[model samples]
Target: MTTTQNQDTLERLREDYPGWRIWRSRRGTRPAGWVATSLTPQDGRAPTLHADTAEELELQLKNPPMGIGLDIPGQLEWSGGR
Candidate 1:
Protein backbone atom coordinates (compact mmCIF):
# COMPACT_ATOMS: atom_id res chain seq x y z
CA MET A 1 0.00 0.00 0.00
CA THR A 2 0.98 3.71 -0.10
CA THR A 3 2.52 5.74 2.70
CA THR A 4 -0.77 7.48 3.45
CA GLN A 5 -2.56 4.13 3.65
CA ASN A 6 0.08 2.76 5.99
CA GLN A 7 -0.19 5.79 8.25
CA ASP A 8 -3.95 5.47 8.29
CA THR A 9 -3.70 1.86 9.36
CA LEU A 10 -1.19 2.73 12.08
CA GLU A 11 -3.44 5.45 13.41
CA ARG A 12 -6.37 3.06 13.48
CA LEU A 13 -4.37 0.47 15.38
CA ARG A 14 -3.24 3.00 17.96
CA GLU A 15 -6.83 4.00 18.50
CA ASP A 16 -8.00 0.44 18.94
CA TYR A 17 -5.22 -0.47 21.33
CA PRO A 18 -4.67 2.19 23.93
CA GLY A 19 -1.07 2.50 25.22
CA TRP A 20 0.15 0.63 22.14
CA ARG A 21 2.43 2.11 19.53
CA ILE A 22 2.63 0.15 16.26
CA TRP A 23 4.87 0.98 13.34
CA ARG A 24 6.71 -0.43 10.34
CA SER A 25 10.37 -1.36 10.45
CA ARG A 26 13.11 0.79 8.83
CA ARG A 27 13.80 -1.76 6.06
CA GLY A 28 11.21 0.07 3.98
CA THR A 29 7.81 1.77 4.37
CA ARG A 30 4.56 0.62 2.74
CA PRO A 31 3.48 -1.15 5.95
CA ALA A 32 5.34 -4.33 4.97
CA GLY A 33 5.71 -5.28 8.64
CA TRP A 34 4.80 -3.92 12.07
CA VAL A 35 6.07 -3.73 15.65
CA ALA A 36 3.93 -3.11 18.72
CA THR A 37 5.38 -1.28 21.70
CA SER A 38 4.09 -0.77 25.24
CA LEU A 39 5.99 0.83 28.10
CA THR A 40 5.74 0.46 31.85
CA PRO A 41 8.13 2.46 34.00
CA GLN A 42 8.34 -0.26 36.65
CA ASP A 43 7.95 -3.35 34.44
CA GLY A 44 11.50 -3.00 33.04
CA ARG A 45 11.19 -4.20 29.41
CA ALA A 46 8.31 -5.71 27.50
CA PRO A 47 8.41 -7.91 24.44
CA THR A 48 7.21 -6.29 21.23
CA LEU A 49 4.73 -7.77 18.77
CA HIS A 50 5.55 -8.15 15.07
CA ALA A 51 3.36 -8.70 12.02
CA ASP A 52 4.21 -9.25 8.36
CA THR A 53 1.25 -7.18 7.16
CA ALA A 54 -1.50 -4.85 8.30
CA GLU A 55 -4.05 -7.66 8.35
CA GLU A 56 -1.94 -9.77 10.63
CA LEU A 57 -1.32 -6.83 12.94
CA GLU A 58 -5.05 -6.19 13.13
CA LEU A 59 -5.57 -9.79 14.23
CA GLN A 60 -3.07 -9.36 17.02
CA LEU A 61 -4.67 -6.10 18.18
CA LYS A 62 -8.13 -7.65 18.36
CA ASN A 63 -6.87 -10.54 20.48
CA PRO A 64 -4.06 -8.71 22.31
CA PRO A 65 -0.90 -10.09 23.96
CA MET A 66 -0.09 -12.08 27.14
CA GLY A 67 -3.62 -13.43 27.32
CA ILE A 68 -5.01 -10.02 28.32
CA GLY A 69 -8.39 -11.05 26.92
CA LEU A 70 -9.39 -7.78 25.26
CA ASP A 71 -12.26 -8.18 22.83
CA ILE A 72 -11.61 -5.30 20.46
CA PRO A 73 -13.82 -4.76 17.42
CA GLY A 74 -12.54 -4.38 13.83
CA GLN A 75 -12.88 -0.56 13.79
CA LEU A 76 -12.06 1.95 16.55
CA GLU A 77 -11.98 5.71 17.12
CA TRP A 78 -9.24 7.61 18.94
CA SER A 79 -11.73 9.69 20.95
CA GLY A 80 -9.18 12.46 21.70
CA GLY A 81 -5.61 12.73 22.85
CA ARG A 82 -2.24 14.37 22.29
Candidate 2:
Protein backbone atom coordinates (compact mmCIF):
# COMPACT_ATOMS: atom_id res chain seq x y z
CA MET A 1 0.00 0.00 0.00
CA THR A 2 0.97 3.60 -0.39
CA THR A 3 2.12 5.80 2.49
CA THR A 4 -1.19 7.64 2.55
CA GLN A 5 -3.11 4.38 2.71
CA ASN A 6 -0.88 3.08 5.45
CA GLN A 7 -1.38 6.28 7.41
CA ASP A 8 -5.13 6.07 7.05
CA THR A 9 -5.14 2.47 8.23
CA LEU A 10 -3.00 3.38 11.20
CA GLU A 11 -5.38 6.14 12.20
CA ARG A 12 -8.35 3.83 11.88
CA LEU A 13 -6.70 1.24 14.08
CA ARG A 14 -5.90 3.86 16.69
CA GLU A 15 -9.52 5.00 16.71
CA ASP A 16 -10.91 1.47 16.79
CA TYR A 17 -8.61 0.54 19.62
CA PRO A 18 -8.33 3.44 21.99
CA GLY A 19 -5.32 4.04 24.18
CA TRP A 20 -2.85 2.53 21.81
CA ARG A 21 -0.02 3.69 19.59
CA ILE A 22 0.48 1.75 16.36
CA TRP A 23 3.32 2.04 13.90
CA ARG A 24 5.59 0.24 11.49
CA SER A 25 9.11 -0.92 12.07
CA ARG A 26 11.97 0.65 10.16
CA ARG A 27 13.73 -1.68 7.74
CA GLY A 28 14.29 0.15 4.48
CA THR A 29 12.02 2.14 2.19
CA ARG A 30 9.42 -0.40 3.22
CA PRO A 31 8.55 -1.43 6.75
CA ALA A 32 9.48 -4.84 8.01
CA GLY A 33 6.34 -5.14 10.14
CA TRP A 34 3.80 -3.44 12.36
CA VAL A 35 4.03 -2.78 16.08
CA ALA A 36 1.39 -1.81 18.60
CA THR A 37 2.02 -0.39 22.05
CA SER A 38 -0.67 0.15 24.63
CA LEU A 39 -0.89 3.68 25.94
CA THR A 40 -2.79 2.71 29.06
CA PRO A 41 -1.62 -0.69 30.14
CA GLN A 42 -3.96 -2.35 32.58
CA ASP A 43 -2.52 -4.36 35.45
CA GLY A 44 0.79 -4.67 33.68
CA ARG A 45 -0.77 -7.01 31.19
CA ALA A 46 -0.81 -4.94 28.03
CA PRO A 47 1.74 -6.38 25.64
CA THR A 48 3.40 -4.95 22.56
CA LEU A 49 2.21 -6.90 19.53
CA HIS A 50 4.34 -7.30 16.42
CA ALA A 51 2.96 -8.50 13.10
CA ASP A 52 3.93 -8.76 9.47
CA THR A 53 1.01 -6.66 8.23
CA ALA A 54 -1.78 -4.37 9.39
CA GLU A 55 -4.38 -7.09 9.09
CA GLU A 56 -2.31 -9.51 11.12
CA LEU A 57 -1.69 -6.88 13.76
CA GLU A 58 -5.40 -6.10 13.94
CA LEU A 59 -6.24 -9.80 14.25
CA GLN A 60 -3.72 -10.15 17.02
CA LEU A 61 -5.27 -7.13 18.71
CA LYS A 62 -8.68 -8.81 18.62
CA ASN A 63 -7.28 -11.40 21.00
CA PRO A 64 -4.75 -9.26 22.72
CA PRO A 65 -1.81 -10.49 24.69
CA MET A 66 -2.89 -12.22 27.91
CA GLY A 67 -6.50 -11.37 27.13
CA ILE A 68 -5.89 -7.70 27.58
CA GLY A 69 -7.91 -6.47 24.67
CA LEU A 70 -8.94 -2.86 25.31
CA ASP A 71 -11.16 -2.39 22.32
CA ILE A 72 -14.53 -2.77 23.91
CA PRO A 73 -17.42 -1.64 21.73
CA GLY A 74 -19.62 1.04 23.33
CA GLN A 75 -17.08 1.51 26.08
CA LEU A 76 -17.27 4.95 27.66
CA GLU A 77 -14.52 7.43 27.14
CA TRP A 78 -12.39 7.73 30.26
CA SER A 79 -11.19 11.25 30.95
CA GLY A 80 -9.17 10.40 34.01
CA GLY A 81 -5.43 10.15 33.56
CA ARG A 82 -3.95 6.68 33.64
Candidate 3:
Protein backbone atom coordinates (compact mmCIF):
# COMPACT_ATOMS: atom_id res chain seq x y z
CA MET A 1 0.00 0.00 0.00
CA THR A 2 2.58 2.51 -0.96
CA THR A 3 0.45 5.48 -1.88
CA THR A 4 2.13 8.41 -3.60
CA GLN A 5 1.12 10.65 -0.72
CA ASN A 6 3.10 8.59 1.78
CA GLN A 7 6.18 10.39 3.04
CA ASP A 8 8.03 7.13 3.59
CA THR A 9 7.49 6.18 -0.02
CA LEU A 10 8.73 9.57 -1.16
CA GLU A 11 11.78 9.27 1.10
CA ARG A 12 12.59 5.86 -0.31
CA LEU A 13 12.34 7.22 -3.85
CA ARG A 14 14.74 10.00 -2.93
CA GLU A 15 17.21 7.49 -1.49
CA ASP A 16 16.85 5.15 -4.43
CA TYR A 17 17.43 8.00 -6.87
CA PRO A 18 19.83 10.57 -5.51
CA GLY A 19 20.76 12.60 -8.56
CA TRP A 20 17.07 13.17 -9.28
CA ARG A 21 14.96 15.23 -6.97
CA ILE A 22 11.85 13.07 -6.40
CA TRP A 23 8.83 14.79 -4.97
CA ARG A 24 5.08 15.18 -5.23
CA SER A 25 4.71 18.46 -7.06
CA ARG A 26 3.06 21.15 -4.99
CA ARG A 27 4.97 24.01 -6.43
CA GLY A 28 3.79 27.37 -7.69
CA THR A 29 1.53 27.22 -10.74
CA ARG A 30 2.45 23.66 -11.56
CA PRO A 31 -0.32 21.14 -11.05
CA ALA A 32 0.14 18.72 -8.17
CA GLY A 33 1.78 15.54 -9.45
CA TRP A 34 4.93 13.43 -9.37
CA VAL A 35 8.16 14.89 -10.78
CA ALA A 36 11.87 14.03 -11.00
CA THR A 37 14.56 16.17 -12.54
CA SER A 38 18.07 14.99 -13.38
CA LEU A 39 20.38 17.38 -11.54
CA THR A 40 23.69 16.11 -12.82
CA PRO A 41 25.68 18.94 -14.33
CA GLN A 42 25.20 18.65 -18.02
CA ASP A 43 24.79 21.00 -21.00
CA GLY A 44 21.48 22.00 -19.44
CA ARG A 45 20.04 19.06 -21.32
CA ALA A 46 19.24 16.91 -18.33
CA PRO A 47 16.25 14.67 -18.42
CA THR A 48 13.21 15.55 -16.40
CA LEU A 49 10.60 12.86 -15.93
CA HIS A 50 7.06 13.14 -14.72
CA ALA A 51 4.41 10.69 -13.63
CA ASP A 52 1.05 10.54 -11.97
CA THR A 53 2.26 8.50 -9.02
CA ALA A 54 5.45 7.85 -7.08
CA GLU A 55 5.61 4.25 -8.21
CA GLU A 56 5.52 5.19 -11.88
CA LEU A 57 8.11 7.88 -11.26
CA GLU A 58 10.42 5.41 -9.59
CA LEU A 59 10.07 3.11 -12.54
CA GLN A 60 10.91 5.94 -14.92
CA LEU A 61 13.99 6.69 -12.84
CA LYS A 62 15.10 3.06 -12.98
CA ASN A 63 14.78 3.17 -16.75
CA PRO A 64 14.61 6.62 -18.21
CA PRO A 65 12.84 7.04 -21.52
CA MET A 66 14.80 7.17 -24.75
CA GLY A 67 15.73 10.66 -25.93
CA ILE A 68 14.63 12.07 -22.62
CA GLY A 69 16.58 15.27 -22.55
CA LEU A 70 15.81 18.86 -21.65
CA ASP A 71 17.84 22.02 -21.88
CA ILE A 72 17.82 23.13 -18.28
CA PRO A 73 18.20 26.85 -17.70
CA GLY A 74 21.29 26.62 -15.50
CA GLN A 75 23.87 24.29 -14.10
CA LEU A 76 21.89 21.52 -12.45
CA GLU A 77 23.67 19.17 -10.05
CA TRP A 78 22.60 15.70 -8.91
CA SER A 79 24.00 12.32 -7.96
CA GLY A 80 21.81 9.27 -8.65
CA GLY A 81 24.39 6.89 -10.02
CA ARG A 82 22.88 3.55 -10.90
Candidate 4:
Protein backbone atom coordinates (compact mmCIF):
# COMPACT_ATOMS: atom_id res chain seq x y z
CA MET A 1 0.00 0.00 0.00
CA THR A 2 1.03 3.60 -0.42
CA THR A 3 1.95 5.99 2.38
CA THR A 4 -1.36 7.81 2.10
CA GLN A 5 -3.38 4.65 2.57
CA ASN A 6 -1.32 3.62 5.56
CA GLN A 7 -2.01 6.96 7.23
CA ASP A 8 -5.71 6.66 6.53
CA THR A 9 -5.86 3.19 8.08
CA LEU A 10 -3.94 4.39 11.09
CA GLU A 11 -6.42 7.20 11.67
CA ARG A 12 -9.38 4.90 11.29
CA LEU A 13 -7.94 2.34 13.69
CA ARG A 14 -7.20 5.01 16.28
CA GLU A 15 -10.78 6.25 16.13
CA ASP A 16 -12.28 2.79 16.21
CA TYR A 17 -10.01 0.80 18.52
CA PRO A 18 -8.55 3.58 20.72
CA GLY A 19 -6.66 1.31 23.08
CA TRP A 20 -5.31 -1.22 20.57
CA ARG A 21 -1.73 -0.36 19.71
CA ILE A 22 -0.94 -0.31 15.98
CA TRP A 23 2.44 -1.10 14.49
CA ARG A 24 3.43 -1.33 10.81
CA SER A 25 6.08 -3.49 9.15
CA ARG A 26 6.82 -2.78 5.48
CA ARG A 27 8.83 -5.39 3.67
CA GLY A 28 10.25 -5.38 0.13
CA THR A 29 10.21 -2.41 -2.25
CA ARG A 30 7.87 -3.84 -4.85
CA PRO A 31 4.39 -5.04 -3.96
CA ALA A 32 4.80 -3.24 -0.67
CA GLY A 33 2.31 -3.91 2.09
CA TRP A 34 1.98 -3.33 5.83
CA VAL A 35 1.65 -5.80 8.69
CA ALA A 36 -0.58 -4.20 11.33
CA THR A 37 -0.31 -6.06 14.60
CA SER A 38 -2.69 -5.57 17.52
CA LEU A 39 -1.20 -6.39 20.87
CA THR A 40 -2.45 -6.48 24.43
CA PRO A 41 -1.46 -3.31 26.27
CA GLN A 42 -0.36 -5.32 29.26
CA ASP A 43 1.27 -8.53 27.98
CA GLY A 44 1.78 -7.75 24.27
CA ARG A 45 1.36 -11.37 23.34
CA ALA A 46 1.03 -12.93 19.88
CA PRO A 47 -0.54 -10.85 17.12
CA THR A 48 -3.93 -11.82 15.73
CA LEU A 49 -3.00 -11.98 12.07
CA HIS A 50 -1.24 -10.22 9.22
CA ALA A 51 -3.25 -7.97 6.95
CA ASP A 52 -1.70 -6.91 3.65
CA THR A 53 -4.61 -5.83 1.48
CA ALA A 54 -7.60 -3.60 2.07
CA GLU A 55 -10.03 -6.49 2.04
CA GLU A 56 -8.04 -8.43 4.60
CA LEU A 57 -7.62 -5.30 6.68
CA GLU A 58 -11.35 -4.71 6.72
CA LEU A 59 -12.03 -8.28 7.70
CA GLN A 60 -9.55 -8.04 10.53
CA LEU A 61 -11.26 -4.90 11.76
CA LYS A 62 -14.69 -6.51 11.71
CA ASN A 63 -13.42 -9.60 13.58
CA PRO A 64 -10.03 -9.71 15.21
CA PRO A 65 -7.93 -9.17 18.30
CA MET A 66 -7.05 -5.74 16.84
CA GLY A 67 -8.66 -3.04 14.72
CA ILE A 68 -8.37 -1.62 11.20
CA GLY A 69 -5.07 -0.82 9.51
CA LEU A 70 -3.86 -0.84 5.89
CA ASP A 71 -1.13 0.33 3.53
CA ILE A 72 -1.38 3.21 1.05
CA PRO A 73 -3.51 3.31 -2.12
CA GLY A 74 -5.76 0.67 -0.43
CA GLN A 75 -6.97 -0.35 -3.86
CA LEU A 76 -6.21 -2.52 -6.85
CA GLU A 77 -6.64 -1.61 -10.50
CA TRP A 78 -6.50 -3.47 -13.75
CA SER A 79 -6.22 -2.55 -17.41
CA GLY A 80 -7.33 -4.59 -20.40
CA GLY A 81 -7.81 -3.56 -23.99
CA ARG A 82 -6.64 -4.18 -27.51
* Model 3: pairs clashing at backbone N, Cα or C within 3 Å: 19-79, 19-80, 39-77, 39-78, 44-72
TM-score of each: 0.60, 0.68, 0.60, 0.46
lDDT of 3 by residue, 6-80 (tens): 778888888988888877776696546788888773624336888887778878888777544554456565757
- TM-score for candidate 4, residues paired by index: 0.46
Q: Which ranges in model 4 have alpha carbons more than 4 Å from their true place?
A: 28-31, 41-46, 65-82
Q: Give the Cα RMSD of candidate 3.
A: 10.8
Point out the higher-scoring one by TM-score: 2 or 4: 2
Query: What TM-score quantifies how close candidate 2 is to the native fold?
Result: 0.68
Weakest ten-residue segment in model 1 by summed lDDT? 38-47
Give residue 12's lDDT in candidate 2 (0 to 100).
94
The local lDDT score (0 to 100) that residue 65 gets in candidate 3 is 70
Q: For each candidate, how many residue pairs have backbone atoms clashing (under 3 Å)?
A: 0, 0, 5, 3
**How do the residues 1-82 of candidate 4 rate in per-residue lDDT, one tens digit apiece?**
5778767876776577654555465556554443445555233333555567655765665566532343225373445652
Candidate 2 residues lying further than 4 Å off, grouped into runs, are 44-46, 67-82
Predicted structure with the largest lDDT when compared to the true one: 2
Q: Tell me how many residue pairs clash in candidate 3.
A: 5
Candidate 2 lDDT over residue span 1-82, tens digit each: 9889889998999889886788899887776798998776663445688899999999978877663555665785677976
Error of 4 at 15 (Å): 2.0
